[model samples]
Target: DTAVSQTPKYLVTQMGNDKSIKCEQNLGHDTMYWYKQDSKKFLKIMFSYNNKELIINETVPNRFSPKSPDKAHLNLHINSLELGDSAVYFCASSQVAGGLADTQYFGPGTRLTVL
Candidate 1:
């Protein structure tokens, strides 16, 4: 079974459109993270949540929002998409021990293309 999964593996939308990506994890982890890989393949953390509580909010733009309905699910919504938003988004979950995150299981990334 896949530990972490994401819906709409591929998303193509216009520059001004909005879209969302759903993510779920069966690993029973307490912490989850969202990362964005730019065209250059530089992966950067966008957000992190622990026990359904927002923990880390990176320097990402306000157009990107991450919502965790529960510890097992996290979703990302992008509004007013732009060409610069074209990239791969990944969802990951990990256990927290000693105030640090343990091994993380990543989902099959969702590729976003903005025309």
Candidate 2:
């Protein structure tokens, strides 16, 4: 079965439009997150939620928002799309790991392009 899934694996849009991508996971884990991968392939966390709680990534732009309706899903919405927003967006999740090691499994990613 698929662990993490996202829709619109490829998104092409014009600048100044609003777009949203959906994500879901079946791992039954307590935490879920959104990450953005820049053109340089650097991955950064955008938002995280565990059991319906929000944890923000300090470096994320205000234009990006995350929402989780329940433990199994987390979605990202973007507003006023810009060329700078053209990047890969991935949704992932993991356990708190406590003091142990935790590896976040990522989705195939939604490749968004803004012109």
lDDT of 1 at 46: 88
Model 2 is weakest, by summed lDDT over 10 consecutive residues, at 96-105
* Clashing residue pairs for model 1: none
Best by lDDT: 1
Q: On a 0 to 100 scale, what is the lDDT of residue 34 in model 1?
A: 89
Question: What is candidate 1's lDDT per residue for 70-111, written digit by digit as tens?
Answer: 889999999999999999999988887213437878999999
Worst 10 residues of 1 by lDDT: 96-105
**Would you estimate the TM-scores of all the predictions?**
0.92, 0.92
lDDT of 2 by residue, 1-115 (tens): 8899999899999999999999988988788888889999998878878776787888888899987888788889999999999999999878772112587878999999999
Global Cα lDDT for candidate 1: 0.88
Count clashing pairs, candidate 1: 0
